[model samples]
Target: MNYIIKIIFLFSICTLVVAEEAIFHKNLKIKKDDTTVNVKGGFKIIREQFYKNFKKENNLDYNFLEVTKKNPRHGDTALELTVGTGCIGSKADCKRSNFESKKRVEVSGRKIGKKDDNVWMSMSLLIPEDFKWGGRLTIQQWHNDIEVYEPMFETDIKNFVGLTMKNGSRKGYFVLDKPNKNCSAGSGDGSTGANFCIKSYQEFKLLNWDELLSLKGKWIDIIHNIKFNSDPNKGYFKIWINGDLKVDHKGQTIWKTHGDVEKYFGKNRWDFKFGIYTTSKMAFKLYFDEIWIKRSCKGLKLKRLGYKCKNLLDQEGGVKPYSIKDISGNPELAGTL
Candidate 1:
């Protein structure tokens, strides 16, 4: 068994905004005469319009999603969880909430407006060595619809990014809801159904066992930056692990042509959620922090609020893990965040 990496405590979010896109609006937007878009977190807690951090200890709050301050990755507390289990095969082999295991935490927020631009968000995560490889772990995700004019059941599957873990490895994939010219989402291809769509995973992934073990007990920075497109064939997806750019994909990111898209939702509005969502028999705990979405570093308010930023996050030198060899017998040569 791999040495149980006991990484925990403190978490954060980061979002960058550039002030150049005056055509759009949001927490992070471009100011008049400004060319930079300000970055900020995508989450907005009740009573607090711009929540910089989860500051209160033991004070878990939210609506439509679960919140726990027991196992904080930063600040005085964090979101703690004991995942529920799921089933497979015949119906006889399953039972409970339609035989599904919805064990996870979500930072639920109002649907942001229709957007067809560059969107990015990052979160700090601490997973213990025991977090397992067999469970269905969807640590983070972004869900949106292309039928902005009205809610269309089919469009729900049109675009999404789910950062999932399977067979002991980390993977982030994009599932596009592509319907033909006559393909009314309501009809779902008029045969195969809405679940049928195009899917692609990150090229450079955190799949190396030795690589994951090296950062087991250390806080790893997992980030997702996406460029939403309308052509369903011209967008891009990117990811960074521990400050290292692991996945950089360019191509179609959504499902819609030049005319199918409805008003408002034409550009598309997406819902951002993060936390532990798994189907594991055994209980699991995950710590998350530094949740942010922005256009640049200046858009991030993590440090401005005086929230502690751990310098010892690096697995090796606490600053440069790749510069030397770790005890796990792996040579880390590319971690500097």
Candidate 2:
């Protein structure tokens, strides 16, 4: 009888290991005439309660996608692209909406009046309050149309990063233009360098500029690191491109006066919004599959945000396991200690 009991216990342990290992997974499907992908979390939660209780105490890493099916010259078709979201809203008053709100948002694809043969799309996941500084954002793209944006608000904006691209003889990429004291970075004026722009090789080669003056272009797989060292009075900012030293700025100060720093950091305790954006014109298809954000030094740790598993075996009395809602608001057994 004891041997039989031990055999049963071993089988249960093997099943648990399989379940845990399955948590980290992904699925993607593409067709000649259509493109569809679904990202389902291994963990489920209550859709409504998850967002309501979402705070610094319950932070989790979120993912977004930006992909294209075909070259732009093929003409536009009524394509349907689905994105899973907890909430969505308009340009000014965006908020958490229901799953039915999917139709309201536009999918990145071939648009009218563009000379390029590619499509681009962008989505951003807002960082919850109580997030620490110095984290990494990872972007994986199948094609070349992917561009990730990391916006920072320091005493002064430094270490602006952009993407570089080339098409045959045309060449161009993206860059962050400096903003004027009176104007912000998003403004259309020349003062705001194309915070992120794509240049074609044909355009660059035509300039006939010096070799040193010419911009190099090609398909690139790159990662950018934005670092910030902050105190009460000031902050120092630095950016590393593709794991190499690119731009570094120092002696910068924030909240030089009063309320300056508060105004920026007050919103949900997030320093700034970091995400991706695409232009209406692109020559080739791009894909942004997965993105992971974590506190800079500690790596990616989700448990710090009040996510705890219940120790079912070690109950003080006949206590029941605690249930928490995931981002989708589905009820899930709390993690076991």
The best candidate in terms of TM-score: 1
Question: What local lDDT score does residue 52 receive in model 2, on the 0 to 100 scale?
Answer: 29
Q: In candidate 1, what are the lDDT values of residues 1-337, reduced to their tens digit?
A: 2333322211111111111211112322222222121223334322232222321332323222223333444444333333334321122112222234333334433555344667666566666767655534666556554432211101000002122221100111122254222111222212221322222222233434556556555666665556765443556666556555555555545444334344523355555655444445544556555566665434554353333224212222111111122222221211110
Runs of candidate 1 with Cα error greater than 4 angstroms are: 1-76, 85-105, 146-196, 199-204, 232-234, 257-267, 301-337
Candidate 2 off by > 4 Å: 1-234, 253-285, 297-337
lDDT per residue for candidate 2 within 1-337, as digits (tens), equals: 9999999999999765433311112221222332222112211111223232432233523222223322221222111122223333222112111111111122222112111211111111122123221211111211111112112221110111222211111111223242221212222222322223222111011111232122222111122222322232233223222223222333211211122322432221212212222211111112222122333312312122221113211223211112212221211211100
| Residue 149 shift from truth in candidate 1, angstroms | 15
**lDDT (0-100) at residue 168 of candidate 1?**
7
Best by lDDT: 1
Instruction: Count the clashes in each prediction.
Output: 43, 32
Give candidate 2's error at residue 14 in angstroms.
Answer: 28
Residue 288 local lDDT, model 2? 28
lDDT, residue 245, model 2: 29
Give residue 178's error in model 2 in angstroms: 23
For residue 100, model 1's alpha carbon misses the true position, in angstroms, by 7.3
